[model samples]
Target: MAGRVVRPRQLAFALSHTESLTRDNFLEGPSNETALALIDSWPDWPNRIMLLSGPEGSGKSHLATIWAEQAGARAISAHSLIDTMVPDTLVTGALVIEDLIPGTFDERALFHLMNMAREDEAYVLITARVAPASFAIPLRDLNSRLRAVPVVTVAAPDDQLFRALIVKLCSDRQMTVDESLVSYLATRIERSVAAARRVVAELDAESLRLRRPVTRALAVEVLRDSA
Candidate 1:
């Protein structure tokens, strides 16, 4: 699955986690502990550039934000990378450009940004579901730079992240459920971030239609329907 691409909704599902970028809330497990460590080892980055790659709902954006805040990095999207002097305007040496689509990115601007970052000993962190190798960057120099940058990937949500996601998604809707219910969902639901969010949203609608409280029974029925 090298250089794989995914849908936008898949990436947005990553953002379904709590809005807080506090490091304390970032759950650590075998799955993402390495990626977290790489971020924690920042400023000491080999090339002062890092690429945070992960599947949708893998919490890459959240981790990027945490790193950005700590390193005083300016954050922007790949789409906005072009048509603006955003990169040149960055006062700090650190930059975070997310959602890096290969063909769509502004080759010149991104190339300049990366070049400047290297020359100034600044840092850049990019987040995306797609691999940098998969991007069709036109600028030869930019392509070479991205190819050499470190791409630390966060794996799909682990069991701990799944359970945490269930709680987070429910909390987003102000719905309460027992731990047992969350555990049940963590086991039964699809092992993807999109599944976590979609199920929670569906549960709300299902409960409303049935005029019932969200319960193990309701979840069972909802999952069945979704299946």
Candidate 2:
């Protein structure tokens, strides 16, 4: 029969993939080993109020989500602390304050929140791009408390972690990439998850559009676009 060829639903490509947020999925190496260890050592942490500091896209949010899920925590922002219901949220005993900037935060609200956390024996995990000590804050009480909070840092990914991230990122897109390509990209690209993600996504799309495998030459083109 002379007819137009039709594609079946069974062979449909997934435009998205579920990101499995598990401890195993977190690629751990020397770069972030101490940070991961500290996260795992929660509840036993020296200070109930701790700051997890890391560069952008270094999986801090992922670790925060993991901790929040385990601790039955509530994720809140600096602005949200000013809300009246904040007191109610604090009752959760576990809180993750994401992207807290010292000067931009509500001083009084944070002061009260810390007091309440201590009173209730609650734990606080504050994630930021820099350590608490580096924050520019003039509020004496708030700054004082922030200074005392223990800071755990996740350095930029090492070569091993970077390669692992390439594989994990590809896997997230339901793509099995070549090991040689991974090694090539890992060595050539900066050690950043954001960069890796951009490269992988662009490569996937480019390969699909051309109906070709992910090749070194294609990778070079995509890497330039990623940059």
In terms of lDDT, which candidate is strongest? 2
Q: Please give the TM-score that candidate 2 achieves against the real structure.
A: 0.86
Q: Which lDDT value does model 2 have at 170?
A: 85
Once superposed on the true structure, which residue ranges of model 1 sit more than 4 Å away at CA? 1-18, 205-211
Q: How much lDDT does candidate 2 score? A: 0.82
Q: Tell me the tens digit of each residue's lDDT in model 1 across 96-166.
A: 88888777778888888777676787878888887778877768888888888888888878788788878
TM-score of each: 0.81, 0.86
- Please give the CA lDDT of all the candidate structures: 0.79, 0.82
